[model samples]
Target: MLRKKTLEILTLREGSWAIESAADDLEIAQKAALQFLGKPGVMGVRVLKESVGDIGNPAPGDILFEKLRSTGGADRIAVGEPSSLAPVCEDIEDLFHGGGRTTVNRLFRAYLDKNTVTATEVMHNAREMKRIMDFESMLPSAISKVAQMQSRSEDSPTMGERQNTLFGFADRLNKRAKQAESLDLPSLANVEINEAIHQINKKSNGEAPGYLFRVAASRELINVRNWWGKFAMSVDWAGACKSDPALANLDWFISDALSNASVLQDLLGDQDSLADALISLIEIADGVRSIDTEKAQDATSTEATAAKINGLFKASKLPESKLAVMERVCRQLQGSGALTKDGAEEPKVFREMLLRLIPGTELTGGPEMAEAITHRQSHIINKGGEGGLKAATASVLPALRDPGRKAGYLLSLIESDLGKDLLKDEIEQHLNGLFMTPESVHQIVRTGAPNKKMEKITSIFYRIQKSNLPDSRKAQLTQHLDELLASYVVDGKILDRLDDPNKPLHIRAFMLVSMCQPEMLPDGKASKLAREIIVKHLRRPNFETELVAQVPDEAKKEKILRDFHVQLHRSGFFN
Candidate 1:
């Protein structure tokens, strides 16, 4: 309803007759003035009006009575709009009749009739002012205006005042925007927010202006997000917006606000801020049923948000400066709320990311931390076939030093067939460093070698001789075997004990065969000489018949000789 004021018309006739009545417009005041025209000695009259409530500036008491005091008395009251009044009023007759000749006593008495602002009036006025502001409609424009201020010249004389004005406006707008149980404000997409902040920085040119603008922009973003949070919780936004025109922007506001996660991350790139940004993105991810299903996203919104976050995880080049933030990001990604029920695939992606990340980062313990260990084990074992065995061993040995994460790694080593067969030597080599006692080491050795000490030695020799040992392992084992073989000979000849006729022929043959192992000899002359001895002495007709005659069956004798020939061929003796 339109509010009204009382106009007091004073006529300078018949000892100053006064007429006061309620009116909202000048027409009513003019009509009231005409009432005094017919009164006796009414040469001229003046009219002034005042609202009953505090309607704000241009008070009636100031305009009318101040003019009255300046002009002594007016021939006529200038006709004008209704005026806001002070809260207090005095008696009407006292101003005209009193000797003190106070300024507002007569006017207040004539216009307000000694009334003052009551509590009910004050409440009404406050509500009325609020209705006028319509924060839901004004806040968006205020935010845009604040953004525009960033482009203004910082050297302007009024820049400080402008900053003050913008800040004050933001403060009031923030308070008013949140007045409702829920709130409504502008819908700003993440890209738009990012661009706004970027523009502010660009325009500021890396000076104080840029810093100031960023401060303002950060504040504005916070307000926008806070309002978004309240509004999103207040209603089924899509449903309400469909039926109510007033809520049409609610859906836009929600979609845009939730999508600001990337922009928020960019704005506040510190560890705490990154932590906050990650949590927000998780909440958004959890809230959204699916980008592919419930809410499709555009370049500036939800899909963009998810992309930025995932990209953060995938980025391989993390400098020392960014490690803190990355750590926080990992912590948040591992939280229970980070993934939805159907989002099992997220953990796999997270695990892959953890593999790239864990080498540089030390985990504190969480699902992602656990997943990281699993990934590290897989990385070691699955990298580049047998070619990568050394690298895999190099990788696993260090992680196995940490007792807490060691169990899974040790189990991976023990349980895998390739790990057991191919990595057996490498693993056992680390068992001492892995905190096993001598007895435990003996047990693992017994279980693994299982009275196959000779077999294991033979296998190592076979690998060394065939040059099948990885180049790295071959160099060490070959040198050790050469030194070991030298110990058995005197002056580079077979030991005299074996050469003595006191030794049995088969025993001498076996001893000579041990010395004939190509792996036990050095590569050049020694290996050629060892092969010569094996072919000349060990493969002789007498030696073969003596060795084979021990086998009972004639068929077994022939089979054993053929197997012996195959072994010689494999040892490269035939070639």
Candidate 2:
């Protein structure tokens, strides 16, 4: 069987070789490596091709290809020990926490990247620790950078004091590294984590991760330098150890990275516009590799990409990536200006874009995303031209004269995020115009053909009940509707249909009872009044005799009476 091959590009910065990028194709990796080599600060560049090994196995792989280049004549910057503030560490655990770990991350970021290893991995591995100690300029460079930053503060310690403290911390770190090098630590690459923890005499799995961090610290200072690296690595580890109690710590790191602006920018990459950047971030979070670095292809169609995003969201392994993407998108949506190249040329584009983005935003940010969408709508309403909120509200006014159109318009607003807080009052005002007043209710009940009028009124009431309006508002409006319906029943002499002697008595009773059903009248005073009218007629002396008189056969007459009682009970009349 042929083994799979992968290519990695490494760039030398200062004295350390750091992995710049990776690709499955050698040509693409070489091209990217050459580009990095040409950059001003890069001292050297190389591409390494390695054969894939079996999963969970950490043995060395065969190198299929290698290439190297260096700026031989370029002057190298001299390394110097500076009087800088370093994190004070009393023990190996101290080195893995707070400022000490931060300092290590900054110093050996390139080194860790070059080796494709995590800070936790370095701390536990003796060989990696010795490599850091041997990296001549890393510590000196860290000292200079920290000293420069500390010097800017007004209450910084004296240079002599700072230097002595920093050097002491370095010495302690070196001593711990030597101690770890002397121990026989198990290789993390293939060890059953739980079993390893047991063998090490750790009390719980919660201690497993911490123990690993401490071990890595002993071997070498691990660098979790970039937020992206920290977040991505934590996600990977969290997925691997789902049951581990240390998962919470990994979650914290993920949350911290997602909230950082710099980290968001890193994830968004270099896009020409806000729309592109947002789409890029969304794709990344959804686990879609939208950007084609190898061929430098144009962006995939939005429809295709959206379908891919939806599929990935359903089955994605990296759940935290979606959260990070949403945070960036929320910030972008709230930003000023239009999302397209046309600017305010056509405001409908903004609406269209919003419709497309809202589903994903809602999936990720929920209420936060709704608020962001509201904010954007406010911007468009206040500044976007003829196709803005004012125009939309105005359009609804024309439909107000037609109840069916009016109900449809109001329903549309109630169903969308655009009609949220920004338009809450407007929606309420329109709903009131549709159903609240005596004049509106009268028109709704008396304007059209009897059947059409009933249909329109029912439709309006159904929508009002289901609308996003407050419960008190819905109640008040519905009560008014019920009163209107009751008035129409009385004034239109609708119940008089039951007294039509030409129709069969049972048929008249069935029609009136059906009208009392909730679907026809809902739970309100109107339905109650209809039921009262039915009960009044049913209680009349000889009413049952008159109904049974219409059915000749005794058995058939009893069955008819029984069915009528059951219908009455179900329609809430008997109750």
Candidate 3:
């Protein structure tokens, strides 16, 4: 390499040096004589004195020059070329030969300190050095040292001192990591991050590592906005589902997995995929709902409604819908920095499920909606711990108020034993607050009852009968039922042949008694009117035949008869 030199021209005046010209070179020094004299275009400008030396690498005397040379000073330095890689290689080798953590630490610092050296260049050099020194096998241990140093630093007496050292190491390593992000660096970064997370989980027993997630997110090791996008783009979801039912969880972690708070935030923010998964589960549950509703619609007596719920989870894809996978997603989200104490925006899919399941606002994230209604109901009824009817009813209220799915959802809620009793006093209070209109009620009924051709019809009779609504609302409900039943009762006579069978007659009668409160008549006029209708029906010779035909089980028949006798006695009919 050639070095640029400068010359200093001076005149000896009264034994003091007087500068004439300080030029870039010896030739320029000669031309600069006249210029320095303030007579560049004038004649008779005489040269005073001249001498030259290296500008930045000046040697004062022979002894100084010898000392500088001995130390391999500027004389040995290369110009317009980067420093040799030999030193970096030597330092790496020294570290491999037990130079300790500092050696590796210094290597990273030196690699990043060069203005000319980028992460790509350092990556190339590191690979070459590894190959030349046969240091591939030692890489794992060196990487392990980085993590070990960090872990040890945590135990140091003074936090500042340990933090300084750790930060110093991290500062350089991260700079290199940013440049060599695509370099495939012996899995050092991966090992370190995994170690940190593993240690945190072990210590905290699976608590999320908020700080670590933030750090990883800031580094872009994971794509926050589209964490799952990359993985989703890589694999065929259908194929994975077929191969393993638990693949959703695997795909979540394996796909451009979380590396930072931003990515985690993005993951939590994105709910479409999670919603789709939940919707899939709901569709399956709705399938079972359809079966139960069909059986209820076809049955002649309530005893048939007691048949066990079965074939709900019969789909082969059922295993893929594990709650653990959803829980894993929640775990990833829970660790996000976005979920600060001030209550940040929640993850989308989980929030959607909550809105559909819980009673509060759109942001509700409680686990009240975690399980399917049947599973939750079964859990509440069969197991004795923690669950109460009040809670179950509160959960169902959101469904009841939903105009789109209220009917089917409400039916599903009442289909189970726990669900049937969910309509308690407090829940009815919530229902009243909903201000459910006749139209919404019509939609619910339509959705609940499917016709012979499987076409859905609006039928609020079941909900009206089952709900524990207050008298005022019940009276309003009766008006709606009267309007509905008017089509069946014209000129004060039953017009539908279907009512003559007495099976549906019981269902209609139950709905009427639930609405009218027959025992509350002041003058006994209402009671007499009710009894007259009942007697007219009972006097029909085929009443016994129709009753037996509807309830073939003799014990169930006895129970029905016994209940009617008690109802009649209470209504002042027997007296």
Candidate 4:
């Protein structure tokens, strides 16, 4: 009905000149046609078609009213006969813009007695504002005006696309909010709610994600408020964006997000404990999530390259004075020795930082740690002697402290432990931070004095081997077993002991047959260690042999050698 009336005014306003009794018709037209004559734009006020306001008139209603004045555009075309267009357009401009002169006078009188923004008024006003904004965005003229108002962007060529997407999102969100409001909701909403579970779940293996993780720790409902108690104890934020606040913030995010504490606390069924403490962390993680992961990953990779660049620095062709100055700079770069060193562009400077990161895996007793030192570090070319040397110097601190992260840190160099040792206090501090105690965080299997590594391994292995010598030799045999277990596989001699069961489970059980083969132990100890040589493997939940069989090899063969070894040992082949 409203649209039809608008049409009548627009047509009669444009064609009214054809009417009989021109002066008298114009007088009647002027009075009734005020509805559509205002600003000249698609959505701005103008005589549209006709007016429902017209009564007993020869033609359709004389005016179409809008709240806004006609801006020169589509609405202007609606006002073509300027003689008829001028005054009516001028006077009724407020109709399109809420002058409310037409139907508003009735409500304005009601509000005149009670002027406060009562509940009804608030709801009505909110609806009005929302509709106004939406109406403006819907109009081509208004959209163009808004686009012009925006700072001319480098991406201006794609302005239409951007505007379309942005406006489309706004439109969808507006509709969604309206639907959700009618369905019983609160003033606040989880704006980021995922619609996948509600729509695409059957077609895709996806789950709807919660929009917000409560900030403070609250023992709220069981299914909600669960992300607390997750402290990121130990992190080598060496490759982080530390300078930018976001770097530290993201570090906190990663630590807390990945922390077993967060999930475990939830699983334990009481997340109401100290969970509020995680709010800031959650917010930061949310921000990190807002960014593209690919970009974040690239930044992390850049930092890794930076660390490597430091390791590659050496005395090389640079002058000696420059070298001395570089060393001073490297020391200056360290921050309480928490990170490797500062960004080093010079070879001499970077070399000092690089040396400190040498593979320190041997610092721990675990099989994976040792293997990591071998495989991971081996690939790092020790080009930057200065950085490596400086890192070697600082290695004493962390080496003495946890030996593990230090070792983990060093493993990037593909070199053996260089006797890096942290003091007791330092060890306690570092260990506590990494969410483990000295008792739980075992010392890294490392030796700085490389010359003595062979002697110690031989001694430990021989001592272990001597204890199990078969009767009188039983002691010797026990000793031999220990020797073989600890004994660095030097000349493939350890190949004979692959099936030793009495040895420590972590040692014997973790060994790979391919590891000790003379042909495979290229570095004299071992090369290309087992596929899964990271110490964290033990921390994971366990599964059975058939499950392990699922990991197909490169040629699609599942290497069941681990199964074979376990079976051989079970069958008492060693005995």
Candidate 5:
């Protein structure tokens, strides 16, 4: 049987080699590598061929063909130990801790990406440290770049001072590198990380769990090239990480990677439509893992993914993952362009998508999702030019026939930037027409049952309170509503129920007391009238005796009287 073969193109930058591309054919891989070798800043290129044993149970195969080439010039620098002012790193842990690891990541991102290596890989591997130290221009380039950036700030150190600080950092790294070489420290490849950590702890006073974790994680990432691969590798380690307090850094690393924009984009993949992208993003934000299917690996079925996302949202343990996912979704939601695949703002489609996003926004506690939706609305309105505002306002006019729907539509418009800027007066006029009109007040107070009337009154008051309407407008509307309620109470003879001879004295008192509650009567003329009526009854001769007369037990009668007095006091009826 013919051996299954694969070929890869590798590029050299400074002293490091990174895999650039891969192909199934040797000629295609070699041509691609040769073409890349001639590009500016590319020091060299190598094409290596490998044999695969089987489809299901593949084994590592020998290199069947290999070729290497380098551009002739100053680019071909001999691998020599470069000198710089040492940094403050005292050991392997110091090199990978704090800002040191960030610096390494920034300096060697390309190499890390190409090799599927992490900063953790370099920190524990002596050979990797040596490889970095051999890059003669790496430290100087990093120093110069940092100095340039820092020099832009008014409070920044002088270039020389900044250079000295960076050089000191470099010197520290060099010192640690030399120590690792002298000690013949084993690479992550030579020994398992847990064993390495155990061995190191025996020799040293301090334990290095965080350091060892990164080393093992890096090994797991070996030959994995894409962002999805990194994300998956990080996720696989998450369960193991939860048991060890020292693996907090590993958890943070995973979170940080998941939170990255590029990583999220890759996770969503190239969906056929924006709607597909949106559903996939929601799934990720909701902490739904991709399902592996027989037809395709790591395939995300939209319906299945959304269902899973909705189910897992409340139960998800990974809140950071959800946050990261929502942030990306928010960005897409607010981004410029039509939301639909056909490049048109279809209202029905937009509404459906927004409906889907609302639950996600609540699930993730992201106000940005709401804000983004408003921004998108503004964009759609602005795209229509001057007629946009007029058209939107006209669209709202149809809903005026239905007060509840009108209120909903108006509130949505008022929350948007364009609506705030251009339609403030219009929105305020509409709100006043809706709530402050004499007909509107009469319609609410006169039509419903006592409870239904109270519900309608309270609903209007609540809408006013929750709106972004000005304080003065809110106060005016509330005062008007209160006045109308007070008039209705008087005109409808609602207080006359308290003096009715047919009802029991306690029943009349109970009804009056219920009206005095904040829920039933807000702080206004209506509430004041209810309180005064209750106080009048409370001050009447033999009122307590009549109030509790039906109670058979002397103790119960006394308790009822005392509780009534307390309730009256709490309701602001001092008398």
Candidate 6:
């Protein structure tokens, strides 16, 4: 392993140092050097006093780049062969490890980008490596931590205890309903109805009795028992005796399903069974919604208008379509580092099932998710403590197609993992970490629903930009940059500046660096633009800065690597 070297990393305009000549590898070095130095305001190490081309040596511009062998002082470094920049994430991780502040985190990211490297194989491998490390190392720990905190906080609340009681009450209500006449066995009808009346008597509310009465008047059982006039108009039963088709209308199948729904739901319990049974019972409720459910397919202006669009989904009845929709959504979730194939464990099974069932759920993860996730840390207030995020996620299940709503589930998981001990700062910190993924970028932009943390960060950015961004409203610079860097527009230009060369070097550099973030450059254009920037502008001494004490030793050849970055910045390659 190479010793980690402290490098005085140079920018386009920084000081120079010593470097070993490496003309023997000049051909490869030149192209790599050219590529690295093409971008303006290039960030790299300055390892040499003179460039290879300057000394008139064979392959004059190239120099050998390595960590100093015999304690070569900083001055001993000189220009050298072009070098491969470190992987973007690993580099940023290193920067963080080195105690770089968030500002530097932003700056280095905006400038020296891993996207500058062109090899797809290399980038893919690096990204995959990073992804694996993040998932394997970070996810479980994050989840457990959140769960623990939530559990602890849950204990603090009288509300959670109450909610639990509500849950039990809800369960008991269902059990009581099952004992009612509608769902109970016919032989038990007399006994159950009596019991139901007893329970009804206990209800001080006249509403409960009325609801029970409607269920008690089951026409089907009444006809079999010939018990007319007791709970219905005796004439209606007599009308059926004349064999009138209208009188015998068994459409009560629908109404009966609906009227008995509450009791049935209680019998089934909550969760999936209850959800499914309730959905079925909605048909009866639909009848109730209509003035005449028998004429359900009858057209009014509204139904007539809706008919055209209603031809989708339910009409298609294509299970494959459902699966495809689920697949698309799951892929997006997977890409965002949210879910994926697990060798030893399944992805959150409920979410997986929801994706499979709703198919359209993937689409729901936009604004709805954003709103849900951003509902505040207090939303995940525990089962009954308050409005907690988890409760919010459950409540908004029907809105799963809204990214904002989908965001709730994601946020809850994160909240659950991080737990309540994580103050606002901790939540924001984790979110900052989470937002680095390509998936998160897409969710943020498409959904227009920003997470709590992103909202804060975005507010801060616009605030600073308003005050400090140059007053040059010169011909819409960023729009122009987007055009030139379209190839580099990963998921669309996140911060596409660089319109005028006359702009401040740091500003230009900032835009250049933004194009390099993985979230900002998923489209693979970051490297293309970076190459152009490096080829033109990376040799000057005033366009950039040199961070000598920071670039650690493990870099294969420190001087060569640093010089490579500097030249790239000088060449206007980034612009």
Error of 1 at 409 (Å): 9.9
Off by over 4 Å in 3: 1-272, 280-312, 315-404, 407-488, 491-575
| lDDT (Cα atoms) of all candidates against the true structure | 0.37, 0.56, 0.34, 0.29, 0.57, 0.31
Q: Candidate 4 — worst ten consecutive residues by lDDT sum?
A: 79-88
Residues 283-321, candidate 2, lDDT per residue (tens digit)? 666666444343333223333333333444446533544
Clashing pairs for predicted structure model 2, backbone only: 123-215, 123-216, 123-217, 124-215, 124-216, 129-219
- Relative to the true structure, candidate 6 reaches a TM of 0.19
List clash counts for every candidate, in order: 1, 6, 9, 107, 9, 105
Give the deviation of candidate 6 from the true structure as CA RMSD. 36.6
Top candidate (TM-score):
5
User: Could you estimate the TM-score for every candidate?
Assistant: 0.21, 0.36, 0.22, 0.22, 0.42, 0.19
Which parts of model 1 have CA positions greater than 4 angstroms off? 1-451, 454-478, 481-536, 539-541, 544-556
Give the lowest summed-lDDT range of ten residues in model 5. Answer: 77-86
Off by over 4 Å in 6: 1-309, 312-349, 353-426, 436-575
Which 10 consecutive residues of model 1 have the lowest summed lDDT?
79-88
RMSD list, candidates in order: 30.9, 20.0, 27.0, 26.0, 17.0, 36.6
Comparing 1 with 3 on TM-score, the higher-scoring candidate is 3
- Identify the superior model by TM-score, candidate 2 or candidate 4: 2
**Candidate 1, residues 451-498: lDDT per residue as tens digits?**
232233333334444433356655555455443334324333554554
Question: For residues 118-186, could you state the per-residue lDDT of candidate 4 as single tens digits?
Answer: 111212233422543333212333333333333255645354543454344334434433432232211
lDDT per residue for candidate 6 within 334-448, as digits (tens), equals: 2222222442222234344444333421223322222323342222222433345444434444335433334334443333322333233443343333333323334333444
Cand. 5 Cα-lDDT: 0.57
In candidate 3 the C-alpha lDDT for residue 503 amounts to: 51
lDDT of 1 at 220: 35
